[model samples]
Target: MEKKQFLYMLKLVPELLDEKNWTERETAIIGEHFCALEKLIEEDKLIMAGRTQNKDDTTFGIAILQVDTEEEARYLMENDPAVAKKVMTAELFPYKVALYNPRFTI
Candidate 1:
C-alpha cells in the first residue's frame, strides 16, 4: 500500500506551562515522547516534528508522518506518549507537503 501524509497538532496542558507543576512522572512522559518520535524518524514514518518557541496558550507542536492509512495515522497520534498520558492533547489531519526546502533542518 502507498503511504499518505498526515499531521497531528499537539497542545500542552495549561498546567504544564508552569514549571512548578512538573512532576517526575510528567517529566518522564515527555522524555518518552521525544524517544517515540525519534523512533518514528528512524522508521522513516516521520517527516518532521517541531513546536513554537512561545510559552503561551498559542503554543503548539506538530508531527508530520507518512503512513499507510488514516487508521495508522490516528493510531500514531493517539499513541504519542504526551497524548496518551494527557500531558498534551492532539488532533490529527490529513496533510500534503506542497513544497520542500532541502536546506531546512530541525
Candidate 2:
C-alpha cells in the first residue's frame, strides 16, 4: 500500500530532564515516546523522524516528522508526551518531499 507523505517541523524544550540532575522518570518518559514512535514507524505510519544531538542534551534543538497530512501531523504532535507535558512544543506545518532511489545505477 502506498501512503501519502507530508513533512512537519517540531521543536523541543529541555525542561528538567536535560538538567544535570535528571531523574529516572524523565528517562522513562523519553523511552516511552521512543517505543511508541517506533511502533508507528514500523507500521509505516511515520515516514521519518530526526532530532539534534546537542552537547548539552537540552532536548532536540529542532525535530522533524514525516506523516501523511496536516491533520495527522497535528494528531501525532498532540499525542507525543513531549508536547503533552510541555517537555517539548511542536510547531507543525505541512510540506512536500521528494524521494530518490539510488539502488539502480547504470
Candidate 3:
C-alpha cells in the first residue's frame, strides 16, 4: 500500500517580516519555528521544507509532507509556532510529485 500526502504553502506574515531586517524578537520567534520544523523533519513527517529567495514581499515558505489527510496537515501547520503566534499563515493543497531523484522517493 502507498501512503497519502499533501503539499502545504506557508506564507510569512508580510507585516511581521521586515523587508530589510528582522527584530531580535522576530528572529527568536522564527528560530522557534525553524526548530519546530526540524523536529518534524527528524520525525519523517515532513519530506522537504524551504523558503523562497525572491527577496520581495511575495517570498514565503513551502513544505511537502506525507500525512493521512488534509486535517492532519492542518493540525501540523496550526501547531507550528510561526502560525500559532501569527508570524505566518498557510494554505493547503493536494500535490503530486511528477519527477524527483529516486533516492528521495518515499
lDDT value, residue 31 of candidate 1: 98
RMSD of each: 1.0, 4.6, 2.9
Per-residue CA lDDT of candidate 3, range 42-101, in tens?
988887889988866788888888877778888988888888887789888877777878
Task: Give the deviation of candidate 1 from the true structure as CA RMSD.
Answer: 1.0
Model 2 deviation from the true structure expressed as Cα RMSD, one decimal place: 4.6
Highest lDDT, which number? 1
**In candidate 1, how many Å is residue 76 off?**
0.7
- Model 2 residue 16 distance off true place after TM-score fit, in angstroms: 3.6
In candidate 3, stretches whose alpha carbon ends up further than 4 angstroms from where it belongs are: 19-21, 102-106
TM-score list, all predictions: 0.95, 0.68, 0.83
Segments of candidate 1 deviating more than 4 angstroms: none
Q: Which prediction has more favorable TM-score, 1 or 3?
A: 1
How many clashing pairs per prediction, in order? 0, 0, 0
Clashing residue pairs, backbone N/CA/C < 3 A, model 3: none
* lDDT (10s digit) by residue, model 2, range 1-106: 3345555444546555347645676677777777767877776667557676664545453334555566776787778776675656677665545665779553
Sorting all predicted structures by TM-score, with the top scorer first, yields 1, 3, 2
* Tens-digit lDDT track of model 1 for 1-106: 7789999999999999878899999999999999999999999999999999998789999999999999999999999999999999999999999999999665
